[model samples]
Target: MNNFSSPKIILLEGIVNESGSLHFFEYSEALPFSIKRSFWITEVPQGGKRGVHAHKKETQVLVALKGSVKVSLEGTSGSKHEFILDQPNKALILPAMFWSEVTFDKDTVLLVLSDQEFLESDYIRDKNEFDEY
Candidate 1:
């Protein structure tokens, strides 16, 4: 297991503990970065997937509020890691240039907090293009 500390990998636990319920905590004061946008996924049926790209400027913290999901991360150095997120209070902070994909199991709720506004140009949709960066 790799300890979360890098420009790419940031693991934050207990980010949603204050609300007393996993379904309620949208934001928390314990987060180091300010939230610019908030979103959630509630329709991820089993075998469904989301996120298959990397951001150029946006940084995100992904939390599994309900059920379970798997996050696959590919780094600039060709290193790859997979994290299983099942708890609401924990989060995986993904930085720019790291490609990530999320696959959900059953009725999973994946909440994301972003650091930048939405920009189409900032997104790298091709793995080969992202690897060249």
Candidate 2:
């Protein structure tokens, strides 16, 4: 995992896998805040990319299910680090203010859990202005 100061990025473990039964775990015990929405990305192109922005108040957890993905974390000082997520049970917790980009190796399924719903004003898309902020 990459070390981050402002928006703490943590790798979470212990995700269950069932053969025949389907179970839904409560997010109240695991997360600090309630989960407002849930979404997943499964059909990403080989050379495609996503999430080249940062949120001001939202926190997220990303998981790689099928293939692998390289997450680049950009700081305000132009410092950067990359993390490869391949395991189904592992997740990366991303806080606000950290610029992130996702690049998939082959067809990848990326699951994202958010603390809030979709809000356009919360996003900082410009990389230069994102670095300045």
Candidate 3:
């Protein structure tokens, strides 16, 4: 798909009370796709990287749970974008066919929600392969 759009960042609804704060997500209201798998990235060393690939049929949303994260994306049309996720209430939506690179700050914990399950055929891990995808 050459008509890929930019990544979207949506603010999730949160409630703050005298005790603490709570944030929740529902597929019908918060995400564009239903969640089929979920995971987290944590204990990343300084200057480390993750997500140096693109999914062919999976859409994902990343939420920073502890620290900050920087996400860089490149589309098939050669467009590039960058975003910062520093709040748990904020979610970054990543559609398929976009190469992504993620950098984490100290103690950063990133929660990833995906619309598809793990499939080796769904991943494009090389930049050249992704460009030709």
Candidate 4:
């Protein structure tokens, strides 16, 4: 029902039939940015958290392949957005320079799609370091 107040939320097109349900994205059309790398995060213990950082030059799309995820994004300007992604067709778009924290529910699997490859120097892992930058 579109509970997210942030415009970063994107609802992907899905098809359901007797076989099952399918959700897909076209790189040049549906996605806001082209994908350069993709990865999956799973096996997070209870009350587990991740992504307490921000990127310097990367944008990402977070999708819940299974279960659910609570995502909180805060910009340097003190603006914030919170989202709960429970459906496979729902995704949250995170742009560069916004700090984010993702908390996972039990048995949740998160698929992350990035616009850039993994670069150590591009990560602002410290909240203080991110704020000072």
Candidate 5:
């Protein structure tokens, strides 16, 4: 665990046209795991925040679909990382057991895809609880 590191950010190039822009990601090359579920967080207040837990057995990739978000990651090895998702094409990968916190910019739209389905037992809601895992 001492060697834990935040997964590298994956940048998905988008094609822009007169009508709109298109973006896509493939699990085989863009993500380390297949996406089993997906969710989004939106309409966050100017200073609002979310996510202060670590997953027990799920991996996630997060993207800012409309606005910007700041993500903080804490590893079991006591390593810390912070990333800003300001563009729709950029993403952050969070593997299992990585503690994460999110601070959203006003009206931010964040999308997250999980490698596993919703499972209460797969979440560590408390920092101390996560540390003990």
Candidate 6:
């Protein structure tokens, strides 16, 4: 659906096909950009906060494959929103220039699909710097 293009934070649909013990998530066009890199976050300590930053020019889709996680996003104008993702098919599309903080539950497994490759310079880690950037 590319909800990001329409000023939406999330896409409500995805394909879930389970065969025996394998489950597959198919996101054909739910996201605005094609994923160029994929990674998963695991072993996060309880009540841990990850991704306290904003991307300069990148997009990501976050999914909680195992357990629930809270994603809080801060807009450039200081607006904030939070989403709890507990399902694998429900993906949150976080656009660039939005500061995000992820709170993970115990035994949570978060899967990330990104449009761009890793570049340390692309991240704005400090809130003060993010506001100015």
Tens-place lDDT per residue, model 2, 9-56, is: 444545355653232335443456676767888778886788999887
lDDT of 5 by residue, 29-103 (tens): 556566789999988898788888998778888999988988999898888889999999998888888899999
The whole-model lDDT of each prediction reads 0.76, 0.74, 0.88, 0.85, 0.84, 0.79
Which of candidates 3 and 6 reaches a greater TM-score? Answer: 3
List of clashing residue pairs for candidate 2: none
Q: Which candidate is the best by lDDT?
A: 3
Q: Which ten residues in a row have the lowest lDDT in candidate 1?
A: 1-10
Error of 4 at 45 (Å): 1.0
Q: TM per model?
A: 0.79, 0.78, 0.93, 0.91, 0.90, 0.83
Off by over 4 Å in 1: 1-30
TM-score of 3: 0.93
Model 1: per-residue Cα lDDT over 9-83, one tens digit each: 334443345666434334445345667788998987798889999887778888887898989988888888888
The parts of candidate 5 lying over 4 Å away from their true place are 1-5
Top candidate by TM-score: 3
**Candidate 2: worst-modelled 10 consecutive residues by lDDT:** 1-10
lDDT of 5 at 98: 88
Residue 56 of model 2: what lDDT?
77
Q: Which residue pairs in candidate 3 have backbone atoms (N, alpha carbon, C) closer than 3 angstroms, thus clashing?
A: none
Give the alpha carbon lDDT tens digit for every residue of 21-74 in model 6: 333545555554667899999999989999999988888878888898999888
Model 4 quality (TM-score): 0.91
